[model samples]
Every structure is written in structure tokens, then in C-alpha cells.
Target: MTDKASNSLLAKLGNQLHKNKLVKAGEILLLFIFTYTFIKLIMPLAGDNPLLIQAVVWTANILMLIYVWIGLKLRGESWKDFGLVFGSISLRSAVKVTLLSLLVFVLAIAGFIIGSVIMANITGIPEGANMSGYDYLKGNIWMLIITLAGVYIVSSFGEEVIYRGFLINRISQIGNDSKKATIIAVILSSIIFGLIHYAWGPMGIVQTGFMGLALGISYIKLKKRLWILVLAHAYMDTILMAQLYMASN
Candidate 1:
């Protein structure tokens, strides 16, 4: 094609991305890839300082959130588009969702326990390997507080927005909004979530993957209402922090 023709094609593609909300998805994906690589490079330099590692993680998530916010603006979308509307969901509905989420959380923990037991029997993995990530926060009161705040603010919000709201929606578009496409997106996103927690070892991967699946399913059931997922995740992490604190003491 001629130069002008090629330029026109590029313009059309850009317009398409903006029109379909894929622009934000592409930008976020690129940012995530770059940030992930950068973290891997600098982690050695940061050493085993839990605080530094936590800082790196928070920085990455915050950057992604900013990028996502910008993407939403570029698409002329609001938080409501990502199921963040509080006014539309009634108070009664909110309470019901919260209660149901707690039930789901309990069931998820049970599933994790069963899965861990089965995994141990099948793989012969020792118990302590699964507890690797918890050591950093154990008995560190200040870090524990910071971690709890981070889990609720950074982790719960950032993860739900990126993996569920953005990824599932954008990826499903690739399959032309088919049910199979959505299922694929949920599974793919959940698998990535699990793999990203590799520091927690094999059981961690299994447990996290299971949680991801549960959250993904909930996201779908709730019509992509991220607020519900955020609450659920935050509560789960709060429980974890409490357990960690008790164990350390």
C-alpha cells in the first residue's frame, strides 16, 4: 500500500480500539508487561526486605491503576462501566451480597484445605514450603499493619479491576462476546493470577487459582459489579492478616 493508505489504515485501527474499549486493555497489558519485567530485574537489588518488595508491588499496582483511569477517560467511560456504581445497587442487595460473599469465602477456605491435603498426598510436598511468603510478615507488627492496609486498598481494588473488570471484558471482546469467550477469559485471567503468586509455592498456586476462579465466577454472576468482589477480597485478606498475627504472637 502507499504511505498515505498505510497511515489511513493505522488511523482506522486506532479509532477501532478507542471505539471498542480495547485501547485501555492494550495500554494496561503493555504497562503490566513492562512493570513485571522491571520488578524481576530489581528484585535482586531489593534483596529480601519485605518492605521494599511491598513497595515495589504497591508502586506497580498504583501505576497500573493510574493508566487504567486514563484509559477509561480516553474511552469516555466511568467507574460505573466497571461495575463500581453504588447508587444503582440497593442497600438490601448490598447486604445480601456481602453476606453471601462471606459464605463463599468460608467455602473457599474449606476447598483450599481439601485441595492442600490432596496435593500433599499426591505430590509428597512438605508442609513448610507452603508457608514461605508468610514469614516476612510474621511478628512484624508495623509490616503487618501496612500489609493489611495494602491488601484492602491496593490488592483488592487493583486486582479486581485489572483481572476481572478489564481483562475479562477486553478478552471476551476478542471472541466477539460469546459465552465461550468469556469462560476462556475468566480461566486465563485466573491462571495468570495463580502463577503470579509463585512465591507462595505450589499449594499457594493451587489455592490462589481456586480463589481466582471463585472471584471470576462471582464477577460474572454479579454482572461485573467489582465492588462486591473488592469487599469479598478485602474481607478474605483481613482474615488472613488476623490469622498471621495470631500465629506470630
Candidate 2:
């Protein structure tokens, strides 16, 4: 990077991450490493009542957002910086969000298909993500309803906030928000998104990684209207859970 570019990058990052470029990059790397390692350490304890441990992990993930919130607060920022505001929800916007969600959902599906094909070629039909984590939803009507609420709070909404809003935006900033920087952030965020689904195994990782890539791209294209991404994610979750529920019948 040129001096001007380097300066720009520093100015954008503007803090702990900004000052120490190496540390900033490593922070991202170390987070995923730590997260997965922590999960692996705890998962074995879930031999029989897996739901207990899964719930603990799920709540931990949800609570993990507090770190981001506190980081923002410490910097005199708020989630508004991450596009979690209720901005002028007019009829036009509702329609726009709906349409954009559909567009992104299509793109995500295409990404998933491509990822699936690639995984198949690499691993001879990759084993899918372990849905046993959610096996409680099978024919459990109350659980389905409760899970819907839980997912909307954690998976559909929270994951987008974590992956697209926080990771992409911060990573892009650390690179000075250049085109290349944005692309790198998107790719890195997508990979991490895939990794978080470690229970899915290799195939799940690749497939979700690609889907995350599509979502990341859509996030940037949509001018970071995070609600759109959340809606799109919700659509996917609804479909998956519906399928799981139906499959039991």
C-alpha cells in the first residue's frame, strides 16, 4: 500500500485496531480460533441431553454480541453505526426491503448450490451440517413455535448483525474502506460465518461460506440496510425449520 493508502487505512480504523495493523488482523483470526476451540471443548459434555448444552452455546452466542455493543459504547458509538435503526419505515421501504430480501435469498440459494457442487466434488457428497442440534423441533409443535422466536432473535437477526454488520464493517474500516478492503472484509466475514457452523462439518462449512459470501455482497450492495439482510436470513430460517418440521410428518 502507498503512503496515502496506509494513512487512509489508519485514519479509518482510528483506534486499538487502527494503530496496530498486525494486531487488528490477528484479532479476527484469533476470534474464530478461540470460538471454535471453545465450542469443541464444551460439546462433548452434551452426550445425552444435548439440548442443554446447545442452549448454553446458543445463549453464549447471543450474549457474545454484548462485546460488540460494549465496544461501540466505549467509542461513543451505537448499533446505529451498524445499521440497526428504524429508519423511515414507509410503504416504499417495506416494499423495497421485501424485494431486496428476495433478491438476496435467490443469490444465497445460488451460492449454496454452487458450494454444494464444489463440496461434492471435493469430498464426495459432503456431509451436511448436523441438524441434530435442532432435532428437538421434529414434530414438537411447541418447540417449533418457541424455536421460531428464539431463532428470530438469535440466528436470523443476530447472525446478520454479527457477520455482516459488525465483521464486514469493522474489517472494511481497518482497511480504509477501499474497494479491495471491502472485498477482503466480505470474504473474511463469509468464511468466519461458515466456520461458526462447525457442527455442519466440512460440507456445511463450504456451503454456508458461499451463502455468507452472497449475503455479504448483498449487504454492501444494499448500502448496508441490515434489516433487509435480517429479513432474508429469517426467510431462510423459516424454510429450514419448516422443512425439518414437515419431514417428521
Best by lDDT: 2
- Model 2 Cα lDDT, one tens digit per residue, 168-194: 987987787999999999999999899
Candidate 2: the clashing residue pairs are: 129-200
Predicted candidate 1 versus true structure: per-residue lDDT over 1-249, tens digit per residue: 999998787676556666655653566478669778878877777677766777787777787778677556655678788887756767999789888777666655664676577667878974633544556777778878878888877888898897788777777877787999999988988877777777788877776777787788778877887887888788878877777776767
Clashing pairs in 1: none
Question: Could you tell me how far off, in angstroms, the CA of residue 120 lies in candidate 2 after the best superposition?
Answer: 1.6
| Model 2's TM-score against the true structure | 0.85
Q: Per-residue error at 152 for model 2, in Å?
A: 1.0
- Stretches of model 1 off by over 4 angstroms after superposition: 1-14, 18-29, 86-90, 114-118, 126-131
**Clashes per model (N, Cα, C within 3 A):** 0, 1
Off by over 4 Å in 2: 1-23, 26-45
Reference-based TM-score of each model: 0.82, 0.85
